[model samples]
Target: MIIRPRPHWIHLLFVRRGSLLPRILSQQIFVLLLSCAVVVVHGQLFHWKVTLTSAPFSLMGVALAIFLGFRINASYDRYWEARRLWGTVLIEGRNLARHALTLTGGGVDARPFVLGLIAFAMAMRNQFRGRPRQEGLEGLLPAETVARVQAARCAPALILLWLGQWLQGVREAGHLSPMLAQHMERSVDELSAALGGCERIANTPLPFTYTVILHRSSYLYCMMLPFGLVDTIGWMTPLVVGFVSYTFFALEALSDEIEEPFGTMPNDLALDAIVAGIEASLRELLGETPAPAPQPDAAFILN
Candidate 1:
């Protein structure tokens, strides 16, 4: 997602990167042309005057706007919740890494378990995006462990499993106490819950029918809008309709982008940045001087 400080008021008015303008430009153009055609034909498709009037459109348009508002609200709820879940990810990752480091006390080799935490973050990010397993972990983990986790159906879950086994072995070897092990177990459980929460949002979207209805209603309203206003607005129907069409089209497009917050869209959650932060912070806790943090794109987008 685009991560930048706020801009000036004038810049906000014209800012294009984080806005829905890019996605809805084609739709806006189509609506503008449709409005122009209605104006040319004088709101009459053939010779029929289209039989559409301002009264019904005004009533229907209000209802449609309300419906669109609800859709945007729902999408924002999903977006905000996804963000909170990932916040939990960051907190719990730090907790896990710190606990493991202290438990090992520079004797039991904490790097492997720390490496598992890093792998879990990477795997979870890829899983949320529905991408295949990632590479580049051969140097951090044993080749066999890396290969096994990557080949698993859910790579993040597999990494957690390996971490659990390591924890159990440490306890059995009398290196870690049961109470501290249980604390680590609780942190791992929280990690698993965070994963499940992300999966829920990624897999379960707003119903298809709801989107279909909203899309059809938006298009119909925008198309017939000119016909309704052509009588009162006269030659200015195209200009007025263009502005109104932009509002509705932009809302619809924004709703679609934010509804699924785990994707690589400009407005989706910044999984890449979040994962990088987790990796770097965990390594620092393990007393390893890591490289610089991740950087955003030219547009300040993290993903």
Candidate 2:
């Protein structure tokens, strides 16, 4: 997901950050010790030695490669599903705010309602990441309503509740007709569906048994690899095994990081940016003198 080329030393540092370094290095050390033992024992046993087989490499290599492929494929599916759901949320949020503002002929103060929609988007993003909703809702919500929504267990639902109440209030004040209220309520329903889709992706994951099996099998294969190659390749086994282990294990860690895209990861969904965009769009609709600019990244990254 990081598109630009990194400097050589920086890329080297990332090898440790990949989460596979500890396991791979531990396995490598164990293999080195085992190789030393074999050399020592063979010298004592009248120059007898055991060489690893290339046949198992050919067969198990194909099988293990296939398993890793399947695991990556499943993880990508989950990542893409999360992205699609959030994209739907962005669209539905704009529609809800637009409906509330224009549906009443722009007579009432739609700024609060429009800001509420933006706040809802940020709240949903924070909810998924298990973060506190303190910052993003500031300009986008009334003080009293923001406090209430912050105290509520489900932030998205609380935002929807506020939207419903506002629509009801508009009707009571003879600002909007019941028919328009119904139409606005249907728009809220679409936003709710988008929230539900997001929750579905977060709650359900690929089967636990399958994930455990792949991880266990991968570790076993990695542990056995140096032993299988040592007799022939000798010290060269470390370099080869290290490179191969890095590839497989790095991919595994990358998949885990991206599988849930709402988190505070490098390749996560740009929720902050997206919510800021919604605010800009709504403020433009309100005919504000100076519409707020898009959220700027701090050092090329959103905090």
Candidate 3:
């Protein structure tokens, strides 16, 4: 996610963004240097040669690769599920706003109110991620509702409360019939469900013990690898261990970074941009002017 122009020294920086390759390599280099220093000082390091066909390492390497692959795949599955839930939010959001406009039969001002409700969904999405956009949100809501919603810890819940109030008011004003009100309420319920699903995915992570096991095993394997190979490879053991460790650590770290897609990490699903897209769609459905454009930073990585 850190986009530095390709380093002039290397033709390709591996094209593997968001990986821990750099950090892993740096750590391995440090350890290798320390080991080299110790061996140089002892002068008895030549006796430590290891066999290339060591059964333990070969078997362990195969098992380790399989585990790392499984972990990465599972992490990606979680990330994608979060995205799919949000995608449902986007679709339902547009439908909700449309339902309000067509089903409510309120006047011109009411259409803006409906558009505002759509904006609230976007604001709530951002708020859940601990990123409330000050300008966009404040510009979208009634001052009193905004103040009250801001005061509350749960922004999405506040949005639902306000939405319920709006629907009730319209129903009372004779703009929305009982049947239409019921239909709109169903849309709100769907939105609420989407919110709950997102929260569940964000809150319930892969088990701590499982994550710890993989992480600990990865480092332990890398550490022991050099020791086992020191007799045969000498100083070259470090280079080999460094490369192998970099691959393992890079995959694990990348998976961890993206596991919680609601987070602010670069690889996290772009909830803000996605919400903005939903807002734009809703506004277009309502035929409103002054609709905000989709995010300019959509080019940034979100996968």
Candidate 4:
């Protein structure tokens, strides 16, 4: 996502890289022009004056602001939960890697097991973003394992299955006791739960009808605002309408951008960076040299 040092107050007002202004600029301009036209005509249409008062708009604005607040809160909840689930994945992946190295009695090669944890994280990232499984798995996993994951309907779930099989094989080979294997198995189960949580959030979004109603209401309120203020504010009606419309439009766009936290939007969670960090941490746990951490782009977007 947009990761950068906070800008100065004046720069904050004019910053365009991560702002939502670009997405709603056209709408704001249209509303400003409409407001200007209404003011020029003195709130008249076809020789008939459209009389309106600010009192109703004041009440509607209050209600609309409250509803928009609720919508944004709901979207932020999803975004935060998704981030927490990834945090769980990172933690559990580290735990599994440590277990693979220490608890296997040094008789079993832990590289494959550690690599499986990384593969699971990559597969989950790809699945959430609707990408193909083979993008980065060829180098991390065996060809047969990658083939199995690619062919499976759920690549992350399949990788988890392979992980379980590895634990079982280690136990059977006398490299690990049954109790220790079960302990590592619990970490794998935690990874599974995290995977399922991410799946639920990705598959089930906020209801479409709710989004439609909120979108229509925001536009309707902005479009009808100029007439209400024209009679009272006179020449300043366009300026007032422009500012108000910008607030409503920007909030609506922000909600839409963050509703699906796994997306490639500037505001969405940085799944690419998150997956890379997980891989790096796991490799470090295995005493291997991890790759460099991902750097943000020139625009300060990490994904």
The lDDT values for all models are 0.84, 0.71, 0.70, 0.88
TM accuracy, model 2: 0.77
Ranking by TM-score: 4, 1, 3, 2
Instruction: Go through the candidates in order and give the C-alpha RMSD of each one to the true structure.
Output: 2.4, 4.7, 4.4, 1.9
Tens-digit per-residue lDDT, 141-243, candidate 3: 7788778766777777787777888888888888888998888788788878888887888779998887998999887787667656666666776577667
Quote the lDDT for 104 in model 4.
83
TM-score of 4: 0.96
Model 3: residues >4 Å from true position, as ranges?
Answer: 1-17, 22-25, 31-53, 106-108, 132-135, 230-236, 289-303
- TM-score of model 3 (CA atoms): 0.80
Q: Which of the numbered candidates is closest to the native, going by highest TM-score?
A: 4
Clashing residue pairs in candidate 2 (N, C-alpha, C atoms within 3 angstroms): none
Candidate that scores best on lDDT: 4
Q: Write the per-residue lDDT of candidate 1 for residues 1-303, one digit (tens) a residue.
A: 776767667767877887878788898899889888888888887688766778998798899999999999999999999998888878988887788777654468877888888888888888878777765466656788888877888888888888899999988888889999999999999989988998888889999999999999999888888988887888898898888888888898889999999888878888888888888888888788876876544463221
Every model's TM-score: 0.92, 0.77, 0.80, 0.96
- True lDDT of residue 285, candidate 3: 77
The whole-model C-alpha lDDT of candidate 1 against the native structure comes to 0.84
How well does model 2 score by local distance difference test? 0.71
lDDT of 2 at 186: 85
lDDT of 2 by residue, 132-226 (tens): 86557887777887898778888898888888898899888888889988977888887888788888878887778887887787677766676
